[model samples]
Target: MNSAEFRAVFRYIQALLIITQASLVLTDHREMLPPSPADINWLMHEWTPTVVRETNYSHRAIIPARNSQTRAAIAKVTTCDASAALTAQFFTEVEPAVRWLRSIYVV
Candidate 1:
């Protein structure tokens, strides 16, 4: 998606979080194609920091990897960019993600 579309979706999620007083953002990226560079740049450099400054949102991205190399790469990228309030992680399964969100008391 383009920047406008991405921003619209993000804003929708923010509005939903504000209305429900929620803190967890569960993004299911299973079976989806890899993100474009623009998307990655916006999310890691822009959206994440914005969320960190504006809210206590913990983002859990469920991204199924095809192999160990992919998993390692995903882990490296996510862990390197994560923050205290923005607990970004890529989970291969939904159960573990649910458990983590619960552990954080944000589910």
Candidate 2:
């Protein structure tokens, strides 16, 4: 196959790997009857970027140790060239969830 085709296949495989790993992590965390502090912390800090090829959107969720830290990290990363759009989505959609998780866990 050509370079473009190979790249597309590689990206698809990468996306699938990311989704699978994220799902496993989420499921393992949920299986704990009462999630430990470490689990909560892991959930907040573990993030993977999945590029949605159909829409050309990259999606990621940041689980911060603190709400303010989340905001600051997002602010910092959003301005950088590599992750600007993903960071924007984090600010718009995922920020609230991150804050809520921080408040609930309060660690």
Candidate 3:
């Protein structure tokens, strides 16, 4: 994704958060990622920990965490860089991912 595409996706995500009636299943099935860790960081920056803390809607982000560009993403959330604690978990499979969402129960 280019910067504009990234920003568009970011805005879309932010828009999704505006609706508070349901859960969000965010599946990033992209075969590749935009060539910038800075964009990833910007995205994380845009979606703040306060949003995670405040929103009642649950989200399941099915991202390829350990072995991809999202490795940086995984590290960012896992470390909670500068208190940017995104409320997401990484999963390579669906069963455990579902279990995790159920386990959290954001509602």
Candidate 4:
């Protein structure tokens, strides 16, 4: 794929990961429980690498170094009831990443 297409896919993957993290937070909050191993497995198995491959195939956009950091943060938050501090951090980290991803989109 061409550079633009690849960038688009990279951006989509970033956005998808951000969304999945947010969804995990919301689900955990609603359920009044920490995220389970199953939840993490689903995120890793069901969502992550597929998006990465698609992104790579289309745009060859480099994955941000911070992506893993963000995922780790999400995992930490998910593993327990989120404190106000954790919630604040999650939004702080996620919003900008999402915005960065959105900026790449053509539409």
Q: What TM-score goes with each of the models?
A: 0.64, 0.25, 0.60, 0.28
Q: What is the lDDT of candidate 3?
A: 0.57
lDDT digits (tens) for residues 52-81 of candidate 2: 222333444433323454344334433544
Candidate 1 residue-wise lDDT, 1-107, digit = tens: 55577667767876777677677867655544445556655666676667666765666555566655444434444654545455565677888888877787824
lDDT against the true structure, each candidate:
0.62, 0.36, 0.57, 0.38
lDDT of 4 at 51: 49
Better of 2 and 3 by TM-score: 3
Using TM-score as the measure, what is the rank order of every candidate, best first? 1, 3, 4, 2
Model 3 lDDT, residue 86, Cα = 41
lDDT of 1 at 102: 78
| lDDT score for residue 27 of model 2 | 11
Model 2 deviation from native, Cα RMSD in Å:
14.4
> In model 3, what is the error at residue 106, expressed in angstroms?
6.6
Query: Quick one: best lDDT, which candidate?
Result: 1
